[model samples]
Target: MILLQLLFSFLQVGLLSIGGGYAALPIIQNQVVDLNHWLTAREFGDIVTISQMTPGPIAINAATFVGTKIAGVPGAIVSTLGTVLPSFVIVLFLAWFYYKYRQLKSIKAVLKGLRPAVTALIAASGVSMIIACFWPDGAVSLNNLNIESFILFAGAFIVLRKFKAGPIKVMIACGLVALIISYI
Candidate 1:
């Protein structure tokens, strides 16, 4: 029953999330943070950051980590499989459909409409993560805001976007600076 619950929870995440791993953050948050209470908001934020720093896709990493946290190895396997299964099936189906009807006007229209929605989901996930990082208790806790973290975030954003720095370099630089700050 626990395994079934885990699988069903992540299955919904896989089926509902449209854009990709990052876009699935909100759905995962709703389930893991808001509903099931498997992880705290701060923990969820940390999970996301750790997932980003790691090699694999964020959603799968999140599913595996959360499942492991909940019920050890078997939970991790079930959750990861649940999170990936719908996407795997959908991709296979879409591959066939796209190959067969690559120029269909209806399909083209649907794809075009999906672009903005996916962007919105990704942006919303980013904003929520930022909020979670800034205010661990809740987004309403303005007094707990960390100015230095915001400065670091702004610096990273500028370096990545304006200067067109590579993400790996930016992350390394940020981590080094954070380490230095800890010593000071």
Candidate 2:
């Protein structure tokens, strides 16, 4: 019964989230933190971190993590399946619809419109994650900020933007720096 409920909640997240994986963050945060009480605010930040570091859609990774944390192996499987099932069905439908309507101007226009919205959602997710990382307790006050993270954020942004460094290189460099800093 708990598994069923978890699956249903994830399914709803998968089905309703429109802009993509990043857009799923707010919904996932709400469901897991507010509705389910499965993870605390700090743990939720860890969830976002893990989701970003993982290889797949953020929503699917989050579901798996949350489920595993809550109920172990069976829970992970059920939650992952729940999150992916919606995308799988939607992809099939879109694949058929897209080819059939490939030349439709309205479809093209809609796609163009969605591009900006998706970009905005991705940007918002980045900003939100930055805040969550620097203030795990949801502290909006500047006095409570994590200086190391902010410096890392600024440095990474400059390297990526001005120097045009490859992301993998940047991440590896940042990880090494963080490791060395922690030892000091």
Best by TM-score: 2
TM-score of 2: 0.61
Candidate 2 residues lying further than 4 Å off, grouped into runs, are 1-79
Assess every candidate by TM-score. Answer: 0.58, 0.61
Reference-based lDDT, residue 178, model 1: 83
- Winning candidate number (lDDT): 1
RMSD of every prediction: 5.8, 5.0
Instruction: Compose the digit string of candidate 1's lDDT tens values, residues 1-184.
Output: 8888899999999998897766789999998899999999999999998997788988889889989999999999999999999999989997999888868899889889989999997899999888876666674566789776777889999989999999999988988998899999
User: What is the model-wide C-alpha lDDT for candidate 1?
Assistant: 0.89
In model 1, which runs have C-alpha deviations exceeding 4 angstroms? 1-83, 139-143
